[model samples]
Target: MKTEFTDIAVIGGGPAGLAAALEAKRAGVKRVVVLERDVELGGILRQCIHDGFGIHRFKKRMSGNEYAQAFIDETEKSDIKAYADTTALELTADRKIYACNSRDGMLEIRAGAVIMTTGCRERTASQALIYGERPAGALTAGAVQRYINIDGYLPGKRAVVLGSGDIGLIMARRMTLEGIEVEGVYEVMSSPGGLTRNIVQCLDDYGIPLHLSATVTKIEGRDRVRAVTVAKTDGSRRPIAGTERVVECDLLVLAVGLIPENELLIKAGAEIDPRTKGAVLNDRFETSLSGIFAAGNAAAVFDLVDYVSVSGEIAARGAVEFLRENTSDKNTENASGGADGYVPVIAGENINFVIPQRVRKGAARDLAFFMRVKTSAPRAELRCLCDGAVAEKKVCRYIAPPEMLSMTPCCAAEREIKIDAVNE
Candidate 1:
């Protein structure tokens, strides 16, 4: 196989990968390459034509496609190399990436440091367990977005969206504008999984029927999705027998959840985080493999694309620092291992998953953490206790499973924070 080497290799062409490559180049990494599988550089954003993306990061409201274009346009003003219509089929335990393209057919690329920003995949109807016919009209919400926005085809005349995820809610409003009827949105949880602003603007303002504490139990159809059966749920989320009803529709879009794509990182022998289902990295975002770094969705499921972009830039900075320091002597293990240093894995009452399982107490490294809550927290104080001392503390507006909370170290130390709760 033909092989080449670069300063850095970014695995995705989405916002995260784009931002990472851009930052790497800006940080003076002369040879930066981004391998994207799609013909376009925008990734899924090209199909997400709906407006609402870019609020915090860009400080301006823009559509997903528009934001994607903005990033593409900016890259043109820089020296980032983007390989469109390319795929990395295999990755070795080291940093060797086996990739293929139309022109090259098959090839390999080695880099001094690798950055994983492969993004995520949407959960489908089958995963949702909504008993349904295998029909043409059953599509994931992201697929529906692609059909309408990119393929120039409307999915259906009438629809019923399952799950109150951000994508599902956005589609509810988009369908209305396209003159399609949205029967209802069924969510198993009492509260929505999307941002609070989305629930207000997309559902409440549009008079869209949002059935909380309920879910679509089954779907009925022959060749196309014709109708769906929904049932009310109690606190336990078990369906109430008599609350079932058949709602007619031509399309069923699933927006249940998104799983991070971490195949490459996992293949590189990186420690995986059980909660995030991504690579386990330290404060600087360097994975168990010293030369291999990760950011964006490959690190965790981020709420907004802006956060993904921010994560990519940070990861790029670390990659640049690694090159400048000329530190390439250590193995992927001792250079990055910290799992044994944790005294004990502690989870505060009501706290969700705490990442970093452990931190090295010495060598003076920055400690960062990712966490969420078991349930909705009106107002909970997030505190970390290490060695019977309050190592770090921060107040949270609300903590829920849908949101991933990140905290950087207040002081430079590899101390593990024993997470716990405090009064509002």
Candidate 2:
């Protein structure tokens, strides 16, 4: 067993971890270490060859690999140390990281602060309740992507995508480009689950039909996926009795949903938000456990990678602040105020949920509140209330559950903030 110490330890060397490690180093942290399970620094981004990333951060459209490479280059130039092929087995609430790698063997890292950026995983066939025989052709969109793009093997010649998520939509286009036929994209919701731009660029541009309010209820085949029964779903998202149709395809690619990868965070005693399935955080991205922070998809499933990197920076800043404060005064108490001074952020009508569920009055700097809507609205009004008084109000031309909305409102001291969205 090897023991190491650092000012900050970042778990997962994807975009979030890379960004956080770099930010911590830039913040004058004496030692910053990033642990990655993969052999390389880039995570899933390495396999994503499609363009449309870096629009918000770089102000230019780039491929996923390109976006990740840019960050990798920056990290290589920085003082932060990266441990590739290292998997974190456990995380303690007190900032101890137990990790293992072929080269390092079992290792224990003690850090002043820790940041979790484990990202997210796709919902599989079983999780989606798609009654099916365990067949080789049934796979998630992400898995197919890795198989096709990374491994250079086509999963199937013909495919039926079960969800209209961004990954499913992109794979529909990717498979078509790779000379595979994409039958159609079936979505359970009336509205598409992906961004409007993806719906246009990936599906509409590729001439692939999107079956809204529809889902695949059953799969048929023993060796491989021979066919699937897709049915129209009613308001309850239940398959209608008489609206079943069979789609014959070799592949059943599921793009159901994404769940944040937070097993280690949960095991470490961090409270999770039921809505986001991520850690409950404050304005600074600090989790329920002091000195522990979460960012990127590990915090919430962000729509854009730009925001993912931003979240890492936020968590790094919080960790740096925590380390500095604790080192300055060993007996200093947690600056986060009491329950009364912590303002609860409520999700009002039509709002799915908001990040940073609570705000410590007068303890936070200018912060952006990220949230998603419950439904689609052509025109909507977003209101931020502080103690029943309107703190900020903005009119948005369009809002949807797929696209995350971010707003930075001036928060008043010692007041509860409520966020709500409604059709205008």
Candidate 3:
């Protein structure tokens, strides 16, 4: 066993972890380290060769690998230390981390603060409940992506995608580019789950059909996927009895959903949010556990990678503030406690959920709230209420679940804040 100490220890080396580690180091943290389970610093980005990333942050379209490379380059130039091929096995509420790798058999790290950016995992065939045989060709869109993009091998010739998520849409186009026939994309919801831009570029431009309010109820084949039975669904998303159709294909690619990787956070005694399936966090991105913060997909799945990076930076700033306050005996104001006051931020009407479910008053001059809508709205009014009074209001031309809404409002001296969205 090896013992180490640092000001901050970040788990996971994906975009969120990379960005958080870099930001923490830049924020004057004496010692910062990032632990990545993968062999390389870049996580899933290495497999995402398609362009469309960095549109918000870099102001130019770049490939996922290129976007991750930019951050990797910055991290390498900074004072931050990153350990690749290291898996974080345990995290404690007191900012202790247990991790291991082949090179470092076991590591026990004690840090002033800890940041979790473990990212997310895609929903698989069994999880999605696609009743069928466990065939070799049945794989998630992300798996197929890794197979084709990273490993440079085609998984199948003909495929039937069971979800209309961004990854699925992108893979639909990717498979098409590779001369693989994408029979069609089916979504249980009436509306597409991905961004409109992806629907246009990946499906519309490629002449691929998108079946809405439909799903793959069953898969067939013993050795390899031979076909899938897709059916139209009712309002409850249950497949209708007489609307079943068989689509013959070698591969069944599932793009159903993503689940945040928060086992370590849970082990660390952090409160989990039921809606987001992440962590219940304060305005400073600090989790329920003291000195532990979560960001990016580990906090909640963001529609854009740019937003993921933003969350990481926020968590980094929070960690820096925490370390600065605790390191000095003179700074006795415990920001994690109720000395500054905390206001619960409730999600109301048309909003699925909001990050930073609670806000610590005086933590920041301006607090940013990120949320996703439950349904599409052509015109809507967003309101941030403090103590039943409208603190901020904004009118939007359109809002959808696929695009996360970010609003930064000046902090008010109120103890309660509620964010609401309604069709106008």
After TM-score superposition, what is the CA distance of residue 177 in candidate 3 from its true location, in Å? Answer: 0.5
Clashing pairs for model 1 are: none
Per-candidate clashes come to 0, 0, 0
RMSD of candidate 1 to true structure, Å: 2.8
lDDT by residue (1-424, candidate 1, tens digit) is 7888888988888888888889888888999888999997987888878777888788998988988998899877787778899999877767788999998889799988888888888887778877757877888888888878777788899999998988889988888787778888889988887777888888888889888999888889989988888899999988999999999999987889889888877776788878788887655567777667788887888767787787888778878876765556644332434556433436777766665455544554455666666777777788877666776788987776777676665443444457765648
lDDT of 2 at 157: 88
lDDT of each: 0.79, 0.90, 0.89
In candidate 2, stretches whose alpha carbon ends up further than 4 angstroms from where it belongs are: 330-334, 337-341
**Using TM-score as the measure, what is the rank order of every candidate, best first?**
3, 2, 1
Evaluated with lDDT, which candidate comes out highest?
2
Sort by lDDT, best first: what order? Answer: 2, 3, 1
Higher lDDT: candidate 2 or 3?
2
Candidate 3 Cα lDDT to native: 0.89
Listed in order, each prediction's TM-score against the native is 0.90, 0.96, 0.96
TM-score of 2: 0.96
